[model samples]
Target chain A: MNLRIIKSGVLDTVQDQGRYGWQHIGINASGAMDRFSAELANALVGNDSAQPVLEMHFPAASLFFEQPSLIAICGANFSAVLNGEPVPCYQPILVNKYSILQFERLNQGARAYLAIEGGMNIGKWLNSYSTHLKAGAGGHAGRPLSTDDEIRLNSSVDWQSYLERNEFRVLPWRASDFWEKEPVDEIYILPGREFSGLTELSQLSLTGKTFTLTPQSDRMGYRLLGDPLEMQNREEMISTAVTFGTIQLLPNGQLTILMADHQTTGGYPRIAHVISAHHSRLAQLSPAEKLRFRITDYSMAEVLYRRQQQHLHQIRYACQLKLEWFIHAGH
Target chain B: MSLTIPYHIFPLGDSAMTVDFGSRISPELNSAVMKLYHELQLTPLPGMVEAVPAYSSLSVHYDLLYCSRHRPAEQTVFEWMGELLDKRLRKLDYEEIIPSREVVVPVCYDISLAPDLEMLARERNLSVEEVIHLHQAAPYRVYLLGFLPGFTYLGETDERIAMPRKMQPSPVVAGSVGIAGRQTGIYSLSSPGGWNIIGRTPLKLFDKDREPLTLLKPGDIIKFVSISKDEFEDH
Candidate 1:
């Protein structure tokens, strides 16, 4: 199966879970920014959790399917339409050959994830299909999708019979609720080792204030536009390893949170880390979005993460069973 | 001789932890960090995925789900990791591993490739030849790789030629060799850099399709050998 890109939309790229075990060598773990939606899209179509999916930013892509295929769209609702008919998010749908899938505009969130039934037939670099744009390696020629680009899909069991029955068929079930639809403005964080380096006022300002995401934000980090935070002492720290969600306080008192394409090491003071469970929600936040921080302990953060994992596990199992029944029934 | 360097391990996030060796950058501290990193690579814990070693720290990334399975039901992933790391730290031998073959990096210091050589020499009140002599006089160690893939951060250039980074970074070419604040490194990719460029290398520092991907690794010893522009092109 193959799909031609009619419109490449803003920053469309293929991403899996992430590239791991290579950050030690200064490689960024580039992957889908909103993993919650990426996984949901895959689950809806019975694809593996780590399967590569198309991550489309606001003003998403328009794809023309070359073959009848089963697909699912999740994450930000971009007001998707299949052959000019409105299509819903978070559920699997079958599209016939020559059907055009277009996303008109963003209804919510910053990104949308589209998953094909058998995953994209893309080559992986360092064990991931994620595109690291800076390095020009991995995923669909190591860059964002461009107009007329053709993405190959794995050949699954014949779906031509199903397509003949209907031009477009919507699955009866949807992914169970795990992520919140409402934009999450309050994000929980844990104090970093250098958190104490900040003054009392600066510390209070961090949790007791709202900050706007600056236009300077990108995959590397999200720079906040608000009151500059100050540290008690201006000490030069040796460069150390940083990870996704690591919050660094800049010299100018601005705060930046490292994201998926962040460097391995940073010199700025690390003030806090956004909890892992909220990383997906944070990824959906666009520039100019207002957000407030809340302090949480390690134990509470762990509990929340485990709960979210359990929820995803249940959803995966349910979807697998439903898909097996659909196949066994010869649909 | 074994060195006893004090270090502290702290949680970076839910899935990662950082072991900070010290605040100052020293050969001993870097060795200690690399020693710990190698030991972990040899015998990684159940869930540990990667351990990134920097100048004075090592950030260990792990799989939370895999780790949670091995820990007691009541224990959190962080607690379990802390206990495991503590056990490993207590038993580290801190033996330095010597490289069998020295990696010789060929550099062309000709005026065409050395964009900032004159500026760096003027700032240090030394001749361009003197600057090159000092830079290639001694072998440098690859302390760490960061900022870009395969960008090796070599260290401990002669203090006489040591200088601060430029106030504003200018666009640098790939394979450019630069110096700033007592350290010299080769830029694996073309990027805007603050470091003063004194030379360029013809060899590719990073290649995704290559087996090792990076020509240099942490703890590897590097000796810069100056070559003629023609020699550089031939290589």
Candidate 2:
């Protein structure tokens, strides 16, 4: 069982919840930018959330399925299509062998995940399937998918009988956007240790003004564009550990929100951090997208996080039940 | 004799906290961080994912969700963590110690290998031989590992050879020995750096195949031994 890339996307790679417990050696956990969708994709297919998924950007890869299999396309609505027929996003589908899958239009969001019944047949580096772009290890060949890259599937399902004559069959159940009610423009953040060290104007601007993410952004971080933020005093600081969502003020007076592939440590002054709950939504925002910072406390951040996790937990349970029922009822 | 270290714990983010000893890069401050670091390795906080030790601070990364659910009803996760660290500190001074590794690395100080050696020597009004002698003279402490994997920050170089970082970054090769301010370090991998390159080491600082992953770790004491050009390639 395999999937061959007919055409590659702008940026596509394998990622999971990321590699952890290696920061001591300076190796960071470079996982899915939007973990909620990654997990949702897995849940839809009855696969564990920790399994690796194919993360793709707009102009996503066009692939040909080599075997009948179960799959789910979650996150950014890319107007996914199978054999020229529109397939709904967020729903599991039974894909027949030789079926050509393509993304026709960019509906919304920045990244999308493709989850099969099992997972990507790729080597794990440092106990993670997530691709470390800089180190050139993990994932499929430790690089972006290009034309002719064939990825064998770890799928265990016998879907040939279920597919029958249909090239693809979209399952009835689907997931609603978990962040539907949240405002996209306001990204909640918690002040960092050096928050007070920033000059008063810079501090005010953080919440008062809107900043646009620049094209310079990638897995490393999202560089923001707005009025230059200044510090009260110029100080030589030692490098220290920083994590995903840490907003560091550069010497150039700009701010960068560290993302999935952020190095384990940094020398820049950390000014703020996006709450964990908002990371999924924030990661989906493409370059040129604007957002304002909203300072929040740890307690509120904790509340938001638990709610998000709880919703995901419900989805996983409902999905497992649906998948089990579907499997029992013969096609 | 062991000294009682004073420190303050600050919130790094919602999911992590850092214990900071006031900023002065002395072994005294770093020893406290290493002591805490080694202790955490042996006995980590309940929800801690990992702990990162730096120049004068230790960042404790934890699972916020896990901590919240596991903590006592009255204390918030942060408050509980603070209390946990407080208890750890109150129980002991630095007298109880974990043995640290002492490593000796060889560097080739040939003119071809040392890009900034001639310039650095000229700036300090010293000979090239004097520059290498000063750099390799004292045993330096590995205070932190950051910037890049295995790209260590060894500190308190001989005052005569200690120089500030270059105004602009220079593309340095793997194992490039460099100096910036009072600190000396080696570029574990090929990357652009601002430090003055004084020599090059043949040893691999980082190798995934290696069990330890990095050649150096925080709290290790290190020395640089000068070697010949032919000796560099032979390694």
lDDT of 1 at A65: 93
Q: How many times do residue backbones clash in model 1?
A: 0
TM-score of 2: 0.96
Tens-digit lDDT string for candidate 2 (A22-71): 87777788899999899999989989888999999999999999988899
The residue pairs found clashing in candidate 1 are none
What local distance difference test score does each model get?
Answer: 0.88, 0.88
C-alpha DockQ of every model: 0.77, 0.67
- What clash count goes with each model? 0, 0
The per-residue C-alpha lDDT of model 2 at residue A220 equals 86
lDDT tens per residue, model 1, A104-201: 87777888899999988888898999998878999999999999999987847677776656778898889854345444888999999899999999
The window of 10 residues in a row where model 1 chain B has the poorest summed lDDT is: B93-102
RMSD of model 1 against the true structure: 1.8
Per-residue CA lDDT of model 2 for B1-235, tens digit only, reads 5567788998888888888887678888888888888888889999998898888888898898899888888877788888898788776568766678999999999999989999999999999999999999999999888777678889989899989889999899989999998899998888888999999999999876678889898888998999999999898
